[model samples]
Target: MLSSLALLSVVLPSALAATTYDMVKEYSGSTFFNDWNFYGQFDNLTNGDAIFVTSSVASSSKLAYVDSTTNRAIIKVDNTSTVAFNDKRNTVRISSKDEFDIGSVWIADMYHVPFGCSVWPAFWSQAPNWPSGGEIDTFEHWNLELHNQMTLHTEPGCTQASPVQTATVVNSTDCSFQDNSNAGCGVMDSTDSSYGAKFAAAQGGVFVTEMAESGISVWFFPRSSVPASLSSNASSFSTADLGTPTANWPTAGCAIDTYFKAQNLIFDITLCGDAAGAASVFQQTCSGVCYTDYVVGNGSVYDNAYFDVASVRVYSVTGMNTIVRVSSALGFRAGCWVWGAAALSGAVVLFAL
Candidate 1:
């Protein structure tokens, strides 16, 4: 009886805790565009001076394509054509066809990210219902800021808890969209190589985000610092390997499972929009107004505005049993593994029988 009780204490916890993560979807190479839905419209959300082109326009104009030389995907703005002072330049906005819920991990391997004066680029995830479903900005920054900002925007109640384990600095703790002028709960990366010209110069990096029941964590690994298990061909991953994250939003104050759900990954670049066009924000990076100096140009200023992506992969968590069947040492039924307290009581009855 003593031996059986000791075994139960050790094995029961493993049975409930063991989990495996599997790659459910991958967007990469030539087939990357097939899984995305292009947003062919104006920048209505931010009121930016950008025309999100249709798939046909994107292909015909070469705004989005796979680079033949590097075999990587490239989504870029129109740098060749001249735009009239009143017109908006052509750009691309796309969202994944698939939707992911919590208990998932997203990894993006990149060679470059869009950046320039008046350029607002973001790689993020959001649900269809806006703040109700929640929004997670994995990579976002504009103008001359050389650091990535990770943020979460939800309904009125969500906020970051104290002493969140992260390497980045917290910008705002309030995640409520209605509050803080829509700043959300933001954490800025400390490394200068986190965004823009500096990021591209160091050959780019990777952004990993895990949305779990406990909370949300984001990590930025530069080209030289990426883990070996996170390669493009990796079919599985263990979150335990990723050390202290760049930003962590614990569930002590915010219930992640209630706020975040059914999210679709998105990438878009809008020029001279709300965030980048604000007078106070625009003047910090470049001279002259955003619309007049940058958006209305001959497209020469946006030469560096593009995303050279290697791949974006999503992994879903699946529960699995890791405990081996007991050798009938405690008179347990064959192939019957106990779960909770009820199951454990039944096992004891079977042992007596």
Candidate 2:
């Protein structure tokens, strides 16, 4: 039998009024809605228009879905490959083929970025003309160790110097390949042992960048650590404890406030060489084959190629007024304090009467 999951909802107090929103749930058992629009060069779609299966390595994977439950929508990408050349041999390249846009806000969450001699996984956003509308790369990993980078590709006038933040692992000797430039991008080193065990292990989590009135706030939640409040309330997380700010952020050059406006959500995966203009960047990550054959014999090395989306919700805060009134006992105490002597005599007489 097909199952139906209840949509998640978030409620806030009147004093801290904010907007509330929710994303319509889609699962193995559900009907596809018309609000969704799919864009890319691939096939093998599934799961209520939420999942797309494709075989093209050098194709783009851009799919959008509307959350009927919240009037908002999300654009997603799945695993797709790109084309690149190693000296003379042509190779299908695989980087994180996922990118999306919401109104003016854009986002991309990357995983298994190509490395070694040649590999690049990028999760970036762009506007109309290359860098004209403004490009905000949530995370980008190039050929390096222990370092992750965050860059803003914009007009020449833009002055924000791209800052690269590095992650510090107590035991770096164990997983050295996992380390990279730690710009604003968060990191989980290979020394951790269980770094790339599976999808739930390697890239099992949520990287959210919200563009709201409060400004742009980026959050990274491991699969196990995501808060229910974020899943329920979606909109107002001002009071959430996201920890202290990082040092040397890209605040001086690029004003996040001006560039980040309200945006929709996107979830996608693609291969290298998919994005039209960014072919050179894609070439850097492509290997001999676009995708590696993990299906060895009867067993499979790609055991963790699944995205288990428990739910997606949105929220809008509601306003309410609270009233305070003086208690009866307090009123009587004031009268006694004001009419002491005269009231005492009158009280005795009245009591006797």
Candidate 3:
């Protein structure tokens, strides 16, 4: 005779085993540009009035470079040339050459992030096809906003049904690309130091994201509070050690495996486009028309529009096989449980008999 408790344990997967990560890629210092692909002259998908330059232009203009003194990587918007009205400001948008699937974790150690009127910057991941492939925004903000907004965008049929246990407030529960004018499901970190001027004042920090079949989670650590085990040279890390994340998307609400797919890491800074260019969103934190007042200026207003990155590390999962699908919420309710492999493949059949 099999006990119900024993049966349940055998049928479930262990969250701890699944979350352990081993470092696989590190983008840092002089070699940062080697692994990235410039988008090159493409129209801003967000409708922002910025010109994304090619790798040669970026290198020639010093728009993207490794600081010799600090050994840090810098990616910035052009602040030297005055642009005529209706013309686009030159900027940079780059994506990782390698893509990562589920059971992956990314940690970005940033010393500074872009901020200014009409400036929209983001550190995110996306599938090549988009909408259908899915998008995960690890860190994003526009204008002079004070907090980071993390979001997920996917094709129709995903929703945030389970409440997240984190330090963020949910802005929307729907993750569909068609709803909310394609806003997707978003949550805002509940801290002033998570973005904008304040974050820069504190010398920036780390943003960590975990993507798994069960769900996705994001955490922000101020430079002063970052764990010692996390750094540019870190070889491995355990997500279980990171306390409650800033935002969590559990599987109970959305099928993460179905909506999200292999994703390439990306970073970009654009001016007065898309979300930042919208009159309604722009008026809240900035003044003047988004295009006229900011896009045509001598570029002095964008002195702060840059990223000073210590490193970006990608870790792949280890020790756990993701052959079986499990509900993340079940682990939450059951208090950190794991099922044996034999049970996962054979126990269900025995229980049914």
Candidate 4:
């Protein structure tokens, strides 16, 4: 009787504590962008709650445009010229006016970012560099995917490879790399589709990042399976509501909490050659070229580089636990080892019965 009771206790709690998350926000039309704050100076465009542009020439270039079907805004990039790093030349800033206290877990529904030769598009964050403020690149595709990278640019040692602590995904050799300590850390989702287009598909998906007192976890969910409530705030969801866990949680060598806990969010779409050290990759002949010539020749290549954000929401865990529960039910079945163990344990019980 005692043994049976103990077994019931374990199994019941495990079943009741199923992993679930809430849907904080969702967007599905051209009207969503109306309330966002837009920055950067370019002319010749349409302005409304639906579309925005810096220059009509830039807009026509294809690097910047809007999509009505997927209801996504794209930021395309062309390697022909170096517009990414120029602080003054090309920049687009879009952020939410509402400032919510971001807890450890958050997600972004982004459609795509640039991934061509010599192109750089980043979905990152920043705070004043005081107690040493820094940057976290959630999705960074640089130099033709040779080294799809994510890093923390902070007081030395705060990079992706040197996370202060470590964590791992279940049953896999794949690992998350925290290149620097204070700078930032990230994992690579090496699917063939770019981050932007993947989120914008008809099945629009979810990009989730959870920063717990214990660590951080990030995962993506396709639109078809995403909960309807999470698709829009028409209803509210708590973490406890996320039915079963998905095996996609980060379970490798770096601590997710170390990089994502208690941070503010920033959304900006920058042209090529804007960051500090991204110019050398440009073709030699393309140097000293003006935006007009580049657009005329092959410049308009990046014209569609845009990030359509359906919604951004933050959640608080309110506890200090280190282990993040992930479910293998979504395509990721429990491995052979776990199944074998369960069978052996059950056999032992049957003999006793």
Steric collisions counted per model: 0, 48, 1, 72
* Residue-wise C-alpha lDDT for candidate 3, range 119-235, written one tens digit per residue: 989999876566656888899888888888788888888876654445535555677766654556666776788898999999999999988877888889998888777843568
**Comparing 1 and 2 on TM-score, the stronger one:** 1
What is the per-residue lDDT of model 4 for residues 1-353, given as tens digits with 9 covering 90 to 100? 11111121011112222234443433335544443444434311111111123335335654444576655655443324443322223434443333222344456665444433333455544332222333344555532442223334333333222222111211111122222112123333433343434444443466555544333334445666666655664333455444432312231333443433334344444333322113333332135332333323444554444555555555444442222221222111111000111121121110000
Clash pairs, candidate 3, are 48-273
lDDT of 1 by residue, 1-353 (tens): 11111111111111112235778888888888877778788777677889989888999999999888887888999998889878999999888777787888889999899998999898988776676778898998788777787889888888887524444355567787765456577676778898999899999999998887778888899998888888545888787666667887778878998888767788888887767777766776677899988888689899998999999988888662211121222121111111111122221110000
Query: With candidate 2 superimposed using the best TM-score fit, by how many Å does residue 137's alpha carbon deviate from the native?
Result: 3.4
Candidate 2 regions with alpha-carbon error over 4 angstroms: 1-35, 42-125, 128-130, 139-151, 159-199, 212-215, 231-235, 245-251, 257-264, 272-306, 312-353
lDDT of 4 at 136: 45
Task: Decide which is better by TM-score, 2 or 4.
Answer: 4
Superposition error at 130 for model 2 (Å): 4.6
Q: Ten-residue segment with the worst summed lDDT in candidate 1? A: 332-341
Q: List candidate 1 segments past 4 Å from native.
A: 1-20, 319-353
Model 1 lDDT at residue 132? 75
TM-score of each: 0.84, 0.42, 0.84, 0.51
Query: Residue 275 of model 1: what lDDT?
Result: 71
Clashing pairs in 1: none
